[model samples]
Target chain A: MKWKLLFELFVVFFKIGPISFGGGYAMIPLIEREIIDKKKWIRSEEVSEVFAIAGTAPGAIAVNAAIFIGYRLAGFLGALAAMIGVLLPTTAIVMLLGSLYFLFKDNALVEGAFLGIRAAVVGLITYAGIKVARTSIIDKPTFILFFLILLSLLFLHLNPILAIFIGALAGILTMTAKKKIQQKREEKTHFQNKQIREISK
Target chain B: MILINLSLLFLFIGVISFGGGFAMIPVIEAEVTKRGWLTTSEYTDIIAVAGMAPGSIASNSATLVGYHVAGVPGAIVSSIAITFPSLILILLIAVSFNKINQSPLFHSIFYGLRPIVTGLILFAAIKFAISNGLIASTFSWQMVILLSIFALSLFVLLYYKAHPVLVILASGIVGAVIFS
Candidate 1:
């Protein structure tokens, strides 16, 4: 049973590893389907939690998820198995593809294929951008921040890192203000309720 | 000497890569271009290949850059080295996830990072768009078709929840048909 579990970890991450085009987030649905939904290796809610952990936890999210999932399934050994399985395919493929790519360096068809790939990649990146915005930008402040950032980037051609730094500072301030407001409201409620309780007693 | 240099270079890449592979672009570009390790076109070709290949773009890009610089050994060393820091950081953080998952301060930090990441993606997208003719002076029917494809793909992705791979394949077919 242990060996079979290890095999399952190996096979699942191995399958996801090479086939994960468009990087970390792009593989989310596929990984969710295979591991959580179909295989029942993990629960749907667990997968979402894993994704959240993966994002904030560091490393590549996909690799992190594989390691966690593997650990969940078969413990430490399973994690090693899964990580190796996932990375092996990509390493092997990159080695082969990189070597062979130079052979067709002058081929126009290859050029065209890459050109098409580039255009498609732009679409993919743009789609990812919109999805990110919808999920992250909720309140008016955040929305306005996003719009201003977009305008600054699109027209002013400001550096993104600077914009991000500004946004981070804004977030800190907003969160601090919101926390203070909530604390004050709670205090006011407590005081009023205390007065009311005294009168009743 | 060469292997050591390559490994160290990739290790640096892994550590500083806060926003993943695409964000590593300018840094890697600077290194390769300044060093004359690869031509500009070669670097762009590598970017395209990394985009198509599996795994993290940063890892894959590291692999390609390494391969071009020093062949198979270079690829191995660089990929492993570049991925090492994040891998270690994640493993350590994974152990503490349950304890720290609900911190407001943590959420706020991410909220801060998200817009920055969005800005980076936006900047990258615009650069790609211009390079690929998303905004151009030339107005061919092909341009119109490409724009429509891009617009439709974004719509499907945002509204219809279409899978990225499917969208990519569809775009490829459309490109082959129209461009050919």
Candidate 2:
């Protein structure tokens, strides 16, 4: 029974692996359909929670998600099976393509194809930038933060690790300050209401 | 030596790659260039291929870089190295997911980190454009072709919401026909 379940896990993820282009986000809906809707492996809400956790965790979102889902279903071994299954197709495909690219890299025809592909890649990356920006740059502070980071990266050539660290620190400091101010305001309002009630009494 | 370095480098990248594969590109570019494994344009080619291929772009690129550096065994090592951190992290998170998710501080950090990630991705876009000659010092026919391709790709992705694989394939066809 255990082996059958493991095999099923492998097969399911292996099937989902190849068609999951455009990164992990693209694979989420398909994973949901197969795991939640079709297989009844987990609830839709649970899947969403998994996604949130996956987003926050380090590594590829897809791999983290697969591990969470697999662990939820059948513990560590199941997680390994799911991860291996999902990774296999892409690994094979990439290895094959990578080898081919190396072999023909100097070919004029191949070079031409890459040139065109590279141009289109610019568009793809730009679209990704805009998509994330739309959701993340929601207000003035975030907008300023965004441009500040951009300038640091573009001109100052800041190390990405340093940038990420600075961003996290700024986030913690600003958010904590905001929360403290909010608490003070609430306390003051509460004190005023209490005084009014005592006077009326 | 190369394998060890590649493994260690990818392992570090995997650990710090917060906003998914796109956010990792600049870091990967920095490392690969610094190591003298590939030139900037060559690395961009890997990025293009990685974008077109399956799985995570970071992993795919790692595998390609490993392969470039040492061969199939090198590829395996680098891929494993890149993936290892996430596996360990996810397992830890799975055990304590409730505690982690309930923290307001966690949410706050992400709120700040998200916009920074957005900026990093945009930087990647600009870097690729400049390196690939999409944004040139002087305008020419090649620039026109590139801009048209860029506009067409952006429109298709935004308006029609076409799958990225299809967009990449279409771009490759356009490249083969016109640029050739």
Candidate 3:
């Protein structure tokens, strides 16, 4: 029974490789169908939770979600199975294209094509940055963090790894502080209400 | 060997890359470019090709970078190295999933971490724009042409919501016509 579950996890993620077109965001529906509807492995809400965690965790959403769902199902081996299933097909496809690129990269026409593609890449990455900002930069504080971190990268010569560390630290400190302040404000309001009742009495 | 270096680099990348594939770019650029394993232009090309493939663009690019540097063995090593950190981290987190579920502290950390990733990605885009000569130190006709392509691609992506592969291919054809 355990082995069967692992195998199923592998097969399912292998099938997921080709359909991940558009971007990682687009794969939510496909995962919903395979894991939630067809397999009944999880519920709709649970899938979103998984994707949320997947999105927050480091790595690609598809692979992270696969590992999460697989571990949820069958533990360690399930994770390995699902991750391999995800990477195998992707690696093969990349290698095939990689070989062709290496072979013709020196050709003038290919260089032109690559030049144009590089320009487009800048656009795509920027678009992706905007998409992330839409979600991550919800408040003024978050926007400030985004701005400061960006400036650090561009001017401060900050290591990207350090930026990630600092970012997580900032998130933890500020958000926790925000929650505490809100708690205090609520407490103050509650205390004032008690005073008003006593005075009236 | 260089292969070992490659593995160590990618493994580090897998750990630090919060958010997703785009989040991985600035780190990959820093390490890979420093090592001279790949050039900025080549890195951009890998991103484009990886986007066409299924799965994570980050991992796909790692595979391409590996192959570009060493050979088939390098590709295999990079694929494994890039993915290994994810497996370890997931296993650890999955075991403690219940604790993380209720931890407001954990949630807040991600809330903070994400915007940093956004900043990093924007940094990467700007860096690539400068490095790949889309925006150059000394302006030229080629720079103008590249900027136009960049503008057109960004416009189509944002306004029309066109598929990225089509945009890449369309840009390639435009490049072929103009440059070649």
Top candidate by lDDT: 3
Encode model 1's per-residue lDDT on B7-42: one tens digit a residue. Answer: 887787676565445655545655666678876456
Instruction: State residue B177's C-alpha deviation in candidate 3, in Å.
Output: 1.2
lDDT of 2 by residue, B1-180 (tens): 888899999999888888788888888888888879998899888888888788888898999999988999988898889988887888898888889888888878877888888988889889988998888899899888888888899899999998887888888888878877
How do the residues A136-177 of candidate 1 rate in per-residue lDDT, one tens digit apiece? 777777777777876876688665546656766878887898
lDDT of 3 by residue, A65-140 (tens): 8888888888889888998888788889889988998899899998888888889989988999988888889998
lDDT of 3 at B152: 93
Candidate with better lDDT, 2 vs 3? 3
Interface RMSD after interface superposition, each candidate: 3.3, 1.2, 1.4
Predicted candidate 3 versus true structure: per-residue lDDT over B1-180, tens digit per residue: 979988998898888777788888888878888888878767888888887777787888889889989999999999999888888887777677779878998888888898998999899999999988887779799999899999999999999999888998999899887888
Docking class of 3: medium
- How well is each residue in A6-58 modelled by candidate 2, as lDDT tens digits? 88888888988887787778788898889989999998878778888888787
Task: Considering the two chains of model 1, state its CAPRI-style docking category.
Answer: acceptable
Flag the better candidate by TM-score, 2 or 3.
2
Better of 1 and 3 by lDDT: 3
TM-score for chain B of all predictions: 0.72, 0.96, 0.92
Candidates arranged by lDDT, highest first: 3, 2, 1
